[model samples]
Target: MKVLGSGQYRFERVESWPNVPKYFEMGQPSDVAINSSGEIFVLSRGKHPVTIWTPEGDFIGSWGDGMFSATPHGIFIGKNDNVWIVDCGAHVAMEFAPHGELLRTLGNKNSASPTCEGRLVHAQPFNLPTNLAIAPNGDIFVADGYGGHKVHRFNSKGELLLSWGRQGREPGQFELVHNVWIDSRNRVLVCDDENDRVQLFDTEGKYLEEWTLGNPSGICIRDDIVYFAQLQPFEDKSNGRGSGSISLYNLDGVLLSSWDNTAGGNKDTLIGPHDLCVAENGDIYVCEVYGWRVSKFRKIQ
Candidate 1:
C-alpha cells in the first residue's frame, strides 16, 4: 500500500476500502462521520444516500434511499449516535435517529432562499446550509454556505435561535462558509472556504479571531486539536483542480502536522477532500467529491 505523510502524522493507504452493494452507482461520495462505535457513516448523493461501514472499511449496511435530496451535503454524528444531515438541493437540515428514522428537520424542504445571481453567497436561511455543528448542550450551528453566506443557530427543538454572517472579505463575512465545528472550548469554528480562512466566534455570535487556512472545506475537532481539509492550495484556489490535503492544528490555531497527498505526489492522493473523520484509534477517513471514493488512512504514530 502507498504511504502518505511523515513523522507523527504518517498514514498508510489501504488499497481497497468500502465496498458498496450490488447495482450501486455513485457519481461522487459527499461526506463522512464516525459514530461512537467507530463505525463510519458516509453521506452520498447516489442511489444509497447513507451507508455504514466497519472500522476496517468493510461495508456493513445502507439506508436512506429515497428520503434525501438529489444533492446530499455534510453530516455529523451526535450523542446517542443520532445522525444529522444537510441536503443542499432540498435546502434543509435534519436530525435522524440511529435507526434510520427522521427525528427532526429545519427549514422548508425543496424551497430556495432568495439570492442575487452575481453574489458568491448571501445571508439568509434556506439558501444552502452546507453543514452543521452541535454544541455540548445540544444546540445546532449550521454553516449556510454555497449560496448563503451565513451561520444559523438553533435550539435542540429546532428553533432558529440566532444567525450571523454575510458575503464579504471582512472578518465577520464569508465567501463560502463551508463547514462548522464546535471545539472543546465551546467556540464555533467555521471554514470560510473561498476566503481561505477559518473564522472563530463565541457561542452567542460574537467575533473572536480568524486563521488563514487555504481553501478549507471541512473541520474536525478531536481531543484538543483541530483537523481540517484544504480542498486546494491558496495559489491553486481558482483553478478548480485543487491539490487537496489535511492539516492538524492546536486549538490556538498553531499548525502541528499535515498530510499532503496532492502537490506533485500521487501516492494515495486525496483530491477535493470534502469531509473527514478521526476514529478513537487515530485512523483517519476522508471522502472526496470528484474522486468518488472514501479512502482510509491508518495512523502509524
Candidate 2:
C-alpha cells in the first residue's frame, strides 16, 4: 500500500474505502468530516448532496436534496454531533441535524458583499461564506470567504458579535479568508488563501501572528498537530508542487513535516486536497475540488 508522511505522522493510503450508493455521483467533494460513531459525512455537489456512510464502506443514508444552494462548500461535524455546512453559492453557513433537519442559519440568504472593489467596505455576514469553526462555548466563527474580506464571529444564539479583517497586502489584512478553526487554546486560525498564509487571531478578531505556507485551502487541528490542505495547482511552475500538498505543524506554529512528492506538478498521489480531517483513530480523510474524489489515509504507527 502507498504511504505518506513519516514517523509519527506516517499514514498508509486506503484506496476506495467509501462505497456510495449506485449512481451516487458528485461533481467535486467539497469537504469531509467523521463523527464520534465513525460515520462519515460528506459535502458534495451531487444530486443527493449530503451523504453518510459507515466505517465499513457501506452506504448508510443520504439527505439534503433540493435544499442547499447551487454550490456546496464545507462540512464540519461539531459538538453534540451537530452537522455544520457552508454554501458559498448561496452565501450561508448553517447548522443541521444528522437527518437533514435545519437547526440554525448564520449568514443572510442569497446576499453578498461586493468583492471586486479590492477592499473590504464593512462587516457583512453574507457573501460567499466558506467554512465554520465552533468554539468550546458554542460561539461560531465563519470565514466570510473569497467574496468577502472578513471573519465573522457570532454568539451561540446566532447574534453577530464581532467582525474583523480587510483587504490589503499588510500583515493584518486578508485577500481571501477561506477557512477558520479554533485550536485547543481557543486561538482562531484563518486560512488566508490568495495571500498564501495562515493568520492567527484571538476570538475577538485581534491579529496575533501569521505563517507563510503554500496556498492553504482548509485547516484541521487534532491533538497537538495542525493539518492543512493545499489548493489545486494553477501556475505553470509552482514551487514544490505548491498545490495538492498537505503540511503538518505543531501547536506552537513550528513546521513539523509535509506530504508531497516529485516536482513539476507531478500529482498522482495527492491531488486537489481541498478539505481534510484526521479521525480519532488517526485515519485521514481528504475531500477534493478538482479531482472529484475523496481519499482515505490510515495511520500506520
TM-score of every prediction relative to native: 0.91, 0.92
Model 1 residue 151 CA deviation (Å) reads: 0.6
In terms of lDDT, the best-performing candidate is 1
- Judged by TM-score, which candidate is best? 2
1-301 per-residue lDDT for model 1 (tens digits)? 5556656666777666776656766547788999988889999888788989998666788788899888889999997799999988889988899868999888889887775232533345777778998999999999888777888898888878888877788988888989999988889999999899999999888899999988889788888878888876433435444467888899999888887765336733776788898888778888877567888888886
Model 2, position 300: C-alpha lDDT score? 88
- Give the C-alpha miss distance for residue 247 in model 2, angstroms: 1.3
**Cα-lDDT of candidate 1:** 0.82
- State, as a TM-score between 0 and 1, how close model 2 is to the true structure: 0.92
**Model 2: residues >4 Å from true position, as ranges?**
114-121, 235-243, 261-266
Worst 10 residues of 1 by lDDT: 115-124
Q: How far is candidate 1 from the true structure (C-alpha RMSD, Å)?
A: 3.1
